[model samples]
Target: MNTDVLVVGAGPTGLALGIDLARRGVDALVVEKADRLFPGSRGKGIQPRTMEVFDDLGVLDAILAVGGTYPVGMVWQDGERVGEHRMFDPAEPTEDSPYNAPWMVPQWRTQEVLFARLVELGGRVAFGREVVGFERADQEADGVTVRFAAGPDVRARYVVAADGGRSVVRRTLGIGMTGETVDPNPLLVADTRITGLDRDNWHIFPPRGEHAGYLSICPLAGTEDFQVVAQFPEGTRVDLSAEAIRAVVAARSHLAPESVTEVRWASDFRPRAALADRFRSGRVFLAGDAAHVHSPAGGQGLNTSVQDAYNLGWKLGAVLRGGAPAALLGTYEEERRPVAGQMLGISTGVHRGEVRRGEATRQLGLGYRESSLTEETRTAPAGLCAGDRAPDGKLAGVRLFDAFRGPHWTLVAVGVEAPELPESVRVVTGDEQPSYGKGLFLVRPDGYVGWAGEDTSRLADYLDRGVTR
Candidate 1:
């Protein structure tokens, strides 16, 4: 095989998966059709759960340094400030959950950071190389061969399609997508530089009368630019040129046409939520937008995509390097397809004003409770259970997150007799952990609790299914 994994597309999902595999010492290659990284502030909001995933991938520090909290929304009408609107429900940071709010970092900057981290880990991306078609090996151990539009055919044990919604790979594999348009009205989104608006608040302008649409201009954190969003009529053709953007701002708000100085990037779309019929087909797997497409409403698209990579990365690594059965890779679709469906619903609800961006949008509550990999051995469970996220807290002298911060499982024996675990798995013994209560919590490499029990009778059997001693 040419490589263990071939990741198509160099977006956030592909780069993140590359970083994970490189750190695991897996031979992988990322190929992108574009000559350069994406250049837009489209998916700007990073949810709290994704922040935890970044922490594990070794990019949280840079992400925190470059991103900032979302500002309060300010309403305007006839050039007068009317009221202030809070974008998200306020939540305080607790010991178990340190990141309580959404972070603002342009999608372009997030990709750049992930790319830098991937390069630092010795992973490389081949630009301008697009996949035209691929075929699975006739024999299970022979691997798959992929043909590119401008390069020679490449072979790999597995291939991940991270290419966007219009995925040629998905189409070639005969996969169908099912979804509906979340909004009939066409919306315009742009990144621009304006002079008259203050950077302190997210400016909002409601419709003036029966004819006009609403406009919102938000200052993107960590950058000297603003993201402008406007709604148009059902069949109105949205203009994206710099002059057109300036005209929209001038006609909708108090800002003059000349106040809009530079137009960095602009695009138009009608919000839609979609999910692929299947996430896997033999040796090929679909992830990110290829598997599911969401409305940008609740900021779930990018966060969900990043978590998809995080979930699939470790399973692939374990199958290839940890002597686990190939069937372990099948759990990716089983565990993530339901999550993608739920997130799609949330995004659509937020778009239709049927839901609020509160606990659900934070994504900390999402887990794999119904997954086949989750083993809840305890007859009577307590605070935390299998498939729940292992909350972060100080246990004894070591932080739980510090112990769980790598590509390895963690056995946390809190106020219980510890068992002999595999050398590959890390152990943290503590007298008491407030969030976890008293029990044995087996934290997976992806930061979810894989098993919870009162004793170690079945722990060894669980380990035998995956990791080797």
Candidate 2:
């Protein structure tokens, strides 16, 4: 059997890429080692950028309907409430954002959403199919032959190792993951229901000794269930026993120890930041944990993986259909590599703050306006840079469909003449109401700021960057 793209691992990244490819009428297969979906709330915070990606896939409303909105700001220190940060506010867009705030949902639920969409797109994940080896059809030619357990050899023009950090595909390709796995600190992670607690805010506890942790409580989307998170010293671990969880809850929430019930899931793991020197070798590409791994400081690990899949999906689809150049795939690494590097840096700072119990890391400093793929930064003001995710807002008198509409190339014309704009571009009048800002804007298929200007001088180049002339 063969496919256009054989994605190893059916996690969020692999499933997302599969869905995108299938939606564009490309043949792709997602092979997972596990017999069934992994159940648990590994990482729960979804970023604003990720929500916009969901919108592009036409599943944002369903995911949001299942997941509750977490609009409260974050607090510093454990239980001390030194300061705050807002999750979703209408007042943040710089005249061009498409999403007002991020949504909070469990990792498992996120996979469920993507999986359902993949099925709708005519792509199904082949579970219990493990990819154990890789072969080169030609030394210089970049085609790969993949071997799976108890199945015929599957030959593909391209293969992506969306397998986890400890990827067998990466190892088979002789790709070395160079980074430190050092765990000077260890922490326990658990998912359970705490009956008595305010579901609105994320509660963090004060620092304890050389180690620190927070109790994360958020409403599980579409249920009365509340997911809980508690951290301990690097050397400390979670005791899943009722008494253990109860004691921790009582101390953290100042509630009765018996109030904590239903110990659903739990685990212990250390944190590490590792990145592959290269994301692609020949016809094989690495994504998700296969390409990079970092601490879940900003809840970015899953989101980054999704973005990686998004970046590769369309390029792969276009290349397979002969609509775009193969070199478009090169931009995946060029764009995501630096983003991963920056994420590692920021996560390190976040962990350092948690370890030392220092003040919360300032979030305003975390923007990706430095990437070359971001045309907005080129035309942005003095302080602006590329690599940042585009912002979102609502248009007045527009139906709900128009609000979240468009995988099209969006151009918001300011004072510039709109009548002269090409028919290929979807141009909209700039929004200047109290809920929205004003400026010429362009959004990519994957929800990044592609072009923004007060004039048409840069519009030609911006449109050319995403598609072939």
Candidate 3:
């Protein structure tokens, strides 16, 4: 068997990459070790920047339809309702940034939505096909051969290891993860059907003892189940049984053991931050949890993982279908690894009370200003600059996001003459864009400003030497 790109794991990262490649008419095959999709609600918080990515991927409407904004946190003590506080700093939607708040959609439902979109685009996923190792391809082969535990070997032009933190492919490549434990305690997370809990606010229980940990029960949006999280002291053996979950809820909060009607799913893990030594090794690339594992604080792990796929998908499409050089692939690691490191720090800080869940957690400020691909030619740049995220707004009776949609680059020629370019690049001209002062901006397919300058020479040179169709 053969495929153009082989993607392991069917989580958000793999499914998203499959959708992007499918839209670009790239042949991508996603294989999962399990028989079905992940059934837990682990990564539930979807940041604002990821919402924009989903909008471009055609799943924004579905995601928004099924998800709701995060609720306020209500502190409780001795069964009495205390004062309430905001979980995240509220930000009103501006013309340039529409989705400014964090949305809540369980990790399971998010993956399901992405999988449905991938299927709609004619993408394929083979389940129960666990990747054992890679049958190293010769220099003349031009691709790698992947071996499975039970199925025949499959060859591909490139392999992406989205297999998760316990990534078999990453381990086979001999990549090392270096980091420290964010907290010395272990946390037990579960989805449960409980009585006596309002769906309006996230219930929080402060620690009663000096060594005791905290407890939180958040109403999972768009569902009847509540996500229960409880922390335990270091070296404590955490049990995942339904009975244990009920005991923890009863002991920590005012809820009775019988109030926990049912436990839908449960898991336990210690908070830790780790990053792979490298994201790419030869034709194989590591993405998502396989590349960096973050403490689920501030909801950075899954969002960062999905963006990793978003960043790599277009480059893969450009190299495979378009006439771009393979060196473009190297930028995936260079650009994403640093972003991953920053997100890891943010996650750790949020876990330890060193960072707040506001603009820093929104991820809109992340960029590639120093990337080799970015070219800032303007002597005195203003407002929007190179390598910044292309903000969303109206430009001369047209929406910038609408113009930037689809698998193509966009040239936002604001207050300047629009130049003739290849069909691969979409040009949007506006006399004045409030967010962007007079300038020519080259927006990449992933919606980041790749080149910014008043003159078209930098844009022409970038396309001629660095990018092409």
The candidate maximizing lDDT is 3
lDDT of 1 by residue, 321-344 (tens): 877788888899999999999999
Return the lDDT, model 2, position 357. 11
Full ranking by TM-score: 3, 1, 2
TM-score of each: 0.98, 0.77, 0.99
Spell out the clash pairs found in candidate 1: none
Kindly list the per-residue Cα lDDT of model 3 for residues 1-469, writing each as its tens digit. 8888999999999999999999999999999999999999999999999999999999999999888999999999999988997878889889999999999999999999999999999999999999998876541368999889998999999999999999999999899999999988999999999999999999999998988889999999999989999999999999999999999999999989999999999999999999999999888999999999999999999999999999999999999999799899999999999999999999999999999999999999999999998989988787788999999998888899999999999999889998889988999998989988888999999999999988776678888964656
**Looking at model 1, how many pairs of residues clash?**
0
Q: List the residue pairs that clash in candidate 3.
A: none
Pick by lDDT: 1 or 3, better one: 3
* Model 3 lDDT on a 0 to 1 scale: 0.93
Instruction: Tell me how far the alpha carbon of residue 249 in candidate 2 is from the true structure, in angstroms, after superposition.
Output: 5.6
lDDT of each: 0.92, 0.67, 0.93
Q: Over 4 Å off in model 1, which ranges?
A: 136-141, 467-469
